[model samples]
Structure formats: structure tokens, C-alpha cells
Target chain A: MARTIIPFGPQHPVLPEPLHLKLVCEDEIVKEAIPALGYVHRGLEKLAEIRDFNQMIQVVERVCGICSMLHSQCYCQGIEEMMGVEIPERAKYLRTVWSELHRMHSHLLWLGLFADAFGFESLFMQFWRIRERIMDLNEATAGSRVIVSVNVVGGVRQDLTPEQCSWILTEVAQAGKEIKAIQSTMLSDYTVCKRTKGVAALTKEQAYELGAAGPTLRASGVAQDMRQLKYAAFDKIDFEPVVEYDGDCYARGVVRFREALQSIDIIRAAISGMPQGDISVPVKGNPEGEIITRVEQPRGECMYYMKGNGTKFLERVRIRTPTFANVPPLIAFMPGLELADVPVAVLSIDPCISCTER
Target chain B: MIENMKEITLDAVVGEASKMKSDGQRLVALSCTQLDADNFDIIYTFDKELVLTNFRVTVPKGSDCPSISGIYFAALLVENEIQDQFGIMFNGLVLDFGRTLYLDEEITTIPMCNNTKAMTVKK
Candidate 1:
């Protein structure tokens, strides 16, 4: 037996983050892999102990730039459950709209990153160009491109007027048309098919037993989305979980692509069905109970367990991030792939390092 | 989808809790806090999703709560954390543990609690 070691990141040019992967290869085939984290541990969880409950929403948003809105929403929902406060219908719709927008942008960002990973610079640029439209909508709606600090404990701080809501709906519709074209190109593109087809395949049983969630599990043909539980006015609005079979890299890519389109549809429905009500609801009394909250983020399902003991600060905050649940399954996927395809194979799972390290 | 997931409460299993040893269960986190001057509350989350239903057990102050670390793998770490932060004690947990969230070796008692005072000394 022969072995060789290869280091792949912590400052790699291609990867956007400092995700370092040490690969043990045997003749261009990876046999074992080890992922080294803690590069961006900014003590987000530890900061929760000091930051006020209202301020921790912003702190948790900083946990991951790509999925900031969902992070804040999850944190806020947990606090809301502890306080037993119900948000207004209009605020719920606004949250659903922004959440869908964030999902679209995040999936498109991941799609571009995956394209660039396979050295398809042209496809990458195309996907990113469309992503710019969604970013513009985010900035116009929430006053920030990435970290949209609209979520509070009970409701959203930002309210969408009729004009702003219409403008977002029109722009999102146009973006949806552009995404359809991009999807057609992606599905038929020969290079993408050749590189990703049948690579890093995981069986349905393996996906479920390892606790993989969101698109990864959806790609394996499991319709297990937390949103299906009708969270955040989703029961009022109409939407469906996008799923695909095959459970390969191509299948994961297609699932995300289709989800990006579905998010646009969900946003359109939310904006069109935007009801009339107050945006922010005041929370009273100290939180003094234990509640479990789950939300479907772009990556997968994120759960927060919060316990409050009738104080301004919480007694304990436990986060089960999607990446942490996905890591074990990702490690299980790396054993039987060629060395050259490792990066794309890992990217197929959409590893959010900050979420995992948090 | 698996519907009607079975649930077991912590209050019912308080006395005869040794039945956990026959199962491959482990502790995920043990959190504690002083809710008021009269009583303190401690919570233990177990990794029961695989073998049993994952449940959180709450123990109030002055009660001889049973320690489940002997049957669980990571219960000792969580026990040490609760002891370090809330000044609570587990009868036989391995102590003198390294700090996971705090820097000072001698610091104990919940830092986030309203009762704990901030110490400031001139360098």
C-alpha cells in the first residue's frame, strides 16, 4: 500500500472560505480525508451570553453571511416561542418573502461556486450576474445586501410598503425568467454533465441514517423539508418541496437549481398575498421556559434549543446547525472518490463552515 | 414520514432511571442556572433519538438528582460545564476539567446570571 498527502485550502485561491481539507490519496484516488475547522470561530455562541436578547439576533446573523436572514429568523423564533408571542400576519408574510429571497441568493451563490469549482468560468459568471439582481432587491428591501437586520424577537423591523412590495415582485419575476434560462443551460451543458454525473452518489438509506437534511436529502428523493411543516405563513401561501432522485453530484446541483427557482415562486406568492397588519409586536416579561424551534435554511434544517429562566438573558442556547448534522454524512461521502473531484464533491454538499464551527 | 413519535417525560423516570444503562444513550448537554433565590434549575439533554426519544430532564435545587454520566459517554463533560458555570455539583463526575468557554481556572458560578458581579482590578 502506498499513500500520499495533499493539502487543499485554508488559503486556497478557488475556495471562498478557509476550509482546509487534508487528503490521503493512493494514486490519484482519495482513500481518506480529514477536515480541519476553527478558522473563523468568532465566538458567536459565547457572545450570546453577553449580548441582550434583542442584540443577539444581529450577532447570530453574523454567524454566516450567506444565510444570515435564516440564522436571525431561527434565533428570533426560538426567543418568540419562549415568550409565547405571535407575530402579525403581515410580518409573517414579510419574513417569508425575505427568507425566500435569501434562499434564492444563497442557492445561486452556491451554484456559481460549484460551477467555478469545476473550472467553468463562463457558467459561473452567468449565475453570478443573475445573483446580482437578487442582491439588489435585498439591498432595496432590507437596506443591506448580505446581513439583513430586519428580524426582531416578535416580528421584523422593516415593513414593506405596497410600492416596495410590487417592485420586489416584478423584479423577482424577471429574475425567475432569467433563472429558467440558466437552468436550461445548466441541465444541457456537456461539461457540467460530464464532471458531476454519477459522482459522489449516496444511497437514500445512507442519507437518512446519517441525518442529512435539506437539498442533500431532497436530492436523494426524501421530501423532508422543515418548511413543509408550514412555518412562517407558509401554510397560508402555496409552495412545494423540490426533490430529485439519483443522489449524485448532478442531482444535488439540480436540486439546488430547481430550489432557487422555487424560492422565486414562493417569494412571488408571498408578495402578492402580502396582507395588512402591524409589523413589530412588543414582547413582555422575561422568558422563562424551554422551547425547541426548527427552521429550514438554505443548507438544511437548523434547530435551536433555548431555555430561559425568567431573566433578560437565556439560561442555555443550544444550536444544531445544518452543517453539523451534515458533516458526518459528508465524511461518509469522501471515501470512494477520485482525488481530482474531491473539491466539487465536497462542494456538492454545500458545506457552510461558519455554521458548522458555530 | 414517521408519525406519532413516542415521548417520555423526565418526571416519570426520575426514580427508576437506572434503566438507561441497558441502552446506548449519551448526554448532549447539561445546563444549569439559578432561577431565583429559593431554587435552581438544571437541565440535561440526552442523545436518545437513536435508541429512545430525546428528552430533557429538569432538576430543581435541594433534590438528590441522579447522575446519568455512568451510562452516557459525554455526560461527564456536560456535568463539568454545569458545575463550572452554575456552581452545581455531580456526585462522582470527574472534576478539575479544562475550561471550554472560560479562561480563568478559578472562576465558577454563572457569568450570565444577574447575581454575578463583574470584577475589575487595576493592572
Candidate 2:
């Protein structure tokens, strides 16, 4: 068997972001994969050192365009912990609404990209069409479609009125129904099943050992989610982490599809029980300690480690994104998979290279 | 929560990490913070049922820190990243990228370290 090496993207049609994998193959089967990052690295973590803690939220929000709100929320929570400020009840509920909305858009975006990877052009269009509702909702409420900078140190920057909340609930419910209809085809279709089922399967043990997180870990039956940590009104919300035991690409898809539905339910509940008061609390002084905060991003668990020195500028900000943790599992499962199945398996983890390289 | 952070020696990191792994603590993240001109703090965070436990180790610049990737394979990428950004050395990395994980070789100075001339200029 003659071995050949192929480079799979810093740019690829299937990958919406930049990630390079050097695949060594014997015939049609891949033997190994070496990943190269830094293609999209912008040194955001280093920038954190120069920016003031209050101003750094804006910088952190740009880490990943898909998970921007979650990043800012996580960083703000870390700073709040250091400052010891209690956020308003209304702010917590607002954060919940926007975060769940962020999750819905992110999962929908991923579903469309995943469909595109498998050459299902119509399915891709269907997913993106439904996702537009979320984008419109974001624009109407937060004043931006992509990087909704609604999070501040003590709370969120924006508030949603009762009418706006009701409108969002109606729109989300409509999108949920459509997603449910799409899930039947996305999960049970003959081509999707044949291409994904039993391909790039990771056992529960391997998933934990390789540090897989979020739906990637849940799909392997780990039952771990950062939302369970009860940050930002998650404690008051009623929801369960979606778990699938197959640990295959199909199971990963099923997990995200179900999670999108779960996000809708969570948003509905948060809105129904919306608290009253100000959306933000006044803050004073600089953060002067170190704290680690974790938030459940659409891809998985994103951890932020912030170290402050009693000054406006943070001494260090280390962002450990879900894709960084999930990349090893991608590399681990790449071998023993057919070259054609590589794209399907790679996209299953929902790789966000911008988040990874940040 | 601050009391939960346990400081360990560099030599004890591998053993302590393996013990935690065997006890079912998933490695949440590993972070390196520049402490001073020559000292760095390496923090390893683990989670069990959403409760976090942290282990900290402080090393001098250019010191050889043991790689916990042998026990927890997921540490490889973060370890390589620390090597590149902070210019620290790990003795037993599972997959050593040789300081090319996130930076090019042509860049001679570490970008994230506190003592880097670029960081000093920014300050």
C-alpha cells in the first residue's frame, strides 16, 4: 500500500472557517492527521492585557462571531465574580433570553453548514432560511445581527420589553416547529444515515480522555454541560442537556438538532417568567483577583481565566474555547476513516477555528 | 472557591494530574500567566459534576515543566500553545509542535510573556 499526503484546508468548500489538516492516507483510508492552526489567529488574548477590563468585553465579544454573546457573558461573569457585584434579576433573565437565542442561531448555522458538507444543497437552504428568523430577532432586539454586544460587567446592556418578548416567543415557536420538521429529514434520511451512522464513532471513554465537550461529549453519553453550573439564570430555567449514546456523526447531528429545540423551550420559559427592574447595575473599582468562569457555547464549554492586579487593565485573560478541546478528538478519530467521510466527521464536532485560534 | 485551588510543585504535576484523571475529573483547561520578569504560573483546571478543582504550579522562565499530556492526552494542544506563546519548555509532550502551534518560527520573541519587549512597549 502506497501512502500519500494531502492537505485539507486552511481553505475548503465544506469548512466555513480556516483550519488546516495534513492527512496521510494509504489508498483511500486516512492513517493520520496533523492539524495546523494560527491561520486566523488575531492575538485577542494578548490584546486583553492592553485593554481595560470594562473595554475588554467588546474585544472578547469578537472572539467568535457565532458565539459572540456567550463570550462576552462569560467574561463579564468572571469580572463580576471578582468585583463581587450582584446583578439585577431583570438582567439575568435578559441574559438568558439572548444566550438561548444565540444558541439557536449557532446550532441552525451549524446544521446548514453540516448539510452543505454532505452535498445536500436543498437541506442547507432550508436550515439557513429558518435561521434568518433568529437573525431578524437579534437585529430587532439587540440592534445587531452578528456581534450583539449586550453584555456588560454587572449585567446586560439591553432590555427586552414585554411586547418584544412575546413577539420573540412567537417567532421562536414558529422556528421550532420548522426545525422539528427538518430534523426528521436531517436525521432519518437515507443518505444522511448512510454517510454518518457508525462513521468516526468515539466511545464514551475516548470522549472523556480526549477532552471532548458540549454536544460532542453529551453525544457520547457524558451528561456534562456548563449550563448545569447555573450561571445567568440557568438555575431558574427548566431544561435538560440533550444526550445521545451512539457517539457517531449522526448522533452529533441529532444532539444539535434536539438542542436547538431545547433552546427554544428555554427561551419561552425565561420570557414567561421575566423579572422586573433595571437591566444593569452600577459598578465601581477594578477587578483585583483571579477567577475562572465557564459558559456553555453552541459548540461546547468555553472557559475564561481572568487574572487582575487591582488595576483597570487585566494581567491575563486565557480563553479555552470548546473547539480547542474538541480538536484533539477530531485528530484522534481522523485515522481509520475513509477519505470521503473526513468532511462529515470533521464538521460533526462543529469546529469554530476563530474560537480555537483566538 | 479560591481555597479549592491547590498549589503543586512542577515535579508533582504529572502524578497529581494522573490521580485526578483516575478519579474521574475531566481536564477543563490549562492556562499560563506571566507572574513577573522571570516567573510564570501554570494553572490546570478540572471539573467533576460541574465543581471545579484547580492545581497551580509556578516555574521560572525557560524552565523544563513536565507535560501532563502523557496522562491526559487532551493537554497536548494547550501545552504546545503555552510553549509557543510563553516560550516555556515541556520535557515529555505527546506531540511536540516545537513552538509552532500558534506562531511562526521567524518570530524570535514570545508574544504573551510579560518580559517580552513588545509587551513592555505596550505598557
Candidate 3:
């Protein structure tokens, strides 16, 4: 037998973002995968020197189109902690509503992409069909379908009116019902199960030590979620992480499918308990000192490390996106897999090259 | 300042990292901050049961920092990224990209380090 090297991507039809992996194979089985990034590296972290703490919120949001809101939320959370600004109750619940909506859309987008990876085009369209409703709610409330750009330093910039809140609840409930309708096809379809079950299986120990995050880690039964940190109105809402023991691609898909519905419930709870008042407060001074804030993104835990020097411009900002932490786990499980099955495994962790390269 | 942090020298990084790994703490992240032209501060963050423990090490710009990849395999990516950005060297990387992980070979400036006039290319 002879060994051959295959370049997986910097561009692949299945990949929504560019993540290049050099797959080394002996016959049909992959022996190793060497990953290469930097295709879309924008040096966003280095912009902290020029951009003021307030302006950097916009910069951080561009880290990933899908997980943009969570990125800014994490950034603002750290800035708030450093400045000792406690946001109002309404602001917290408002943040929670948008956050869960973002989470729902992000997971749905991944679900569609994951389905497409396995040649389930109909299933892919079905998931995306349910996802558009969530996007429409974003547009109606936050003025953007994708970026949203609603998080400010002290709190969120947008607030849902009573009518708008009721409408959003109706929309999410409808979307949840639609997603639930397809649960059997996405989960129990023989072809879907055949393509994913037991593929790229990472054990509980392997997932944690390799630094897997979010649904990827939870799918391995670790049950560690940044939402458990009680940021935003999560303190007021009830939540539990979705976990699956198999750690396979199928289990990962099931976790996201369930999480999208979970987001709907979280939104309902936040909106029902959402108090009236201001959505944002005025900031007086620049952030000084260091702080770390972690939030659960659709992909996983997104952590931002902020170092400020009593000036508007931050001294340093380090963003540890979920994809960056999950890459090693992707590599850890790549070996001993058939090269044909690479796409399903890669998409399982929901690789966000924009987040990773940022 | 990190809440659960202890200051350690560059030499003690590997030992401390081993203890974290033995204690079953996940490596949350390894962050590098440039204090000045001459010194860089590296913070290793580990998480267990939702709580974080951090180890801080301050090393000179030109020093060769030890790689903890042997103890915690996931540190390889973090160390490689630091090497490319700050022009620091990790002596024992499991997979050394040699400053080419995120940047092309032709791009010469260290993009993250403002104090450096040029990237120190070394083995």
C-alpha cells in the first residue's frame, strides 16, 4: 500500500468557511490530518491598539457572521465587569432574548450545513426553512438579519416592545414546532444515521483534555456550558445543557437540534419575566484593569480577555473563539477514519474559520 | 488581574501545566500580553468544574519559552500562535509551524507585536 496526501479545503462546497486540512491517507483510511489556517485572518485582535473600547465592539462582532452577537456580548460583558457597571434588569433580559435568538439561528444554520454535508439536501432545506423565521425576528427587532449589532458597552441597544415581544414568542413557538416536526427525519432516517453514527467518536476524556467546547463537548457527555456561568438574564431563566454520550457526528447533530428548541424556551422565559425599564445606561469613563468574560456561543464557549489602561483604547484584547479550542479535538479524532467521511466529521464540530482566524 | 492566578517563572510553566493536567483541568486558553518592548506576559488559564485557575509567566521578548505541549497536547496551537505573533520561541513544540501558522512566509512583520520592528526568525 502507498500513502497519499489530499488537501481537503481552503474552499470546499460543503464548507461555509475556508478551513484547509491536509489529509494523509494509506489506501482509504486517513492516517493524519494537518490543518492550515490564515486564509481569512484579518488581524482583528491587533485592532485594539487603534480602536477605542467602544469602537472595538463593532470589530469583535465581525469575528463571525453567525455568532456575531455573542462575540459583542462577551466583549461588553468583560468591559462592564471592568468598569463596574451593573446593567438594569430589563437590559439583562433583553440581552438574554437576543442571545438565545442568536443561538437558535446559529444552531439551525449549522444543522442545515451538516445535513448538506451528508447529501441530505431536502433535510438541509427543511432546517433552513425553520431558521429564516428566527432571522426575520432579528430583522424586525434589531434591524439586521445577521450581525444584529445590538450589544453596547453597558447593555443592549435594542429593546422589544410588548407587541414585538408577543410576536417574537409566536414566531419562535411556530419555528420550534416546525423543527420538532422534522426530528424523526433528521434523527432516525437510516441514511442520516448510517452516515453519522459512530463516526468521529470522541470520548468524554478525549473531548475535555483536547479542549473541545459547546455542543461538541456536551455531545461527549462533559455537560460544561458557559451559559451555566449565569451571564445576562441566564441568572433569571432556567437552563440545562444538552448532552449525548456517543460523541459521534450523529450525537452532535442531535445536540444542536435539541438546543435550537431549547433556545425558544429560554427566550419565552426571558420575555415572560422581562421587566420594564432602560435597555442601556450611559458610560462615563474608559475601562481600566483586566477581565475575562465567557459566553456560550452557538459554536461553544467564546472568551474575551480585555486589558485596559485608563484610556479609551485597550492595551490588549484576546478572543478565544470556540472553533479555536475545538480544532485540536477535530484533529484528535481525524485519524483512523475513511477519507470520504471527512466532511461529516469536520462539520460536526461546526468549524468557524472566521472565528478561528480572527 | 486574574482572580485565581499565581505568578510563576518561565521555567516553572511546564511543571505548573503538568499539575493542571494531572488535576484534570481543561486548558481554557493561553493568552499573551506584551507588557513592553523587552517583556511579555503569558497567562495559562485552566478550568475545572466551571472555575478557572491561572498561571502567569513573564518572559523577555528574546527568550526561548518552554513548550507545555508535551504535558498538554492542546497547548501546541496556542504556543504556535504566540510564536508567530510575538516572535517568541517554544523549545519543544509537538508540531512547530515555525511562524507560518496564520501568516504566509513572505509576510515579515510580526502582526501582533507593536514594539517589534521586525520578526525574529529562528529555529
State each model's TM-score restricted to chain B.
0.55, 0.90, 0.92
Score chain A of model 2 by TM-score against the reference chain A: 0.99
Give the Cα lDDT of each candidate.
0.73, 0.91, 0.91
Candidate 2, A77-154: lDDT as tens digits: 999999999999889989999999999999999999888888899999999999999999999999999999999998
How should the candidates be ordered by DockQ, best one leading? 3, 2, 1
Better of 1 and 2 by DockQ: 2
Candidate 1 clashes between residue pairs 3 or more apart in a chain or in different chains: none
| Residue-by-residue lDDT tens digits, candidate 3, A1-358 | 8989999998899997789999999999999999988898888999999899999999999999998989999999899999999988998898889989999999999999999999999989998999999999999999999999999988888888899999999999999999989999999999999999999999999999999999999999999899999999988788899999999999999999999999999999999999889888898899999888899999999888889999999999999999999999998999999987999999999999999989
TM-score of 1: 0.80
Candidate 3 lDDT over B20-117, as tens digits, reads 88999999898999998789999899899889898889999888999998888888888889988888889999988899888878777887776465
Tens-digit lDDT track for model 1 on A159-185?
A: 988898888878888888888887766
Structural similarity to truth (TM-score) of each candidate: 0.80, 0.98, 0.99
TM-score of 3: 0.99
Q: Which pairs of residues collide in model 3? A: none
Candidates 1 and 2 compared by TM-score, better number: 2
RMSD of 1: 6.8
**Model 2 superposed RMSD (Cα):** 2.8
- Per model, kept true contacts as a fraction are 0.00, 0.73, 0.84
lDDT per residue, candidate 2, B1-123, as tens digits?
A: 353899999899989998999999989888999898889999999988888899999999767899989889899999988887887878889888888788776666788875463112110
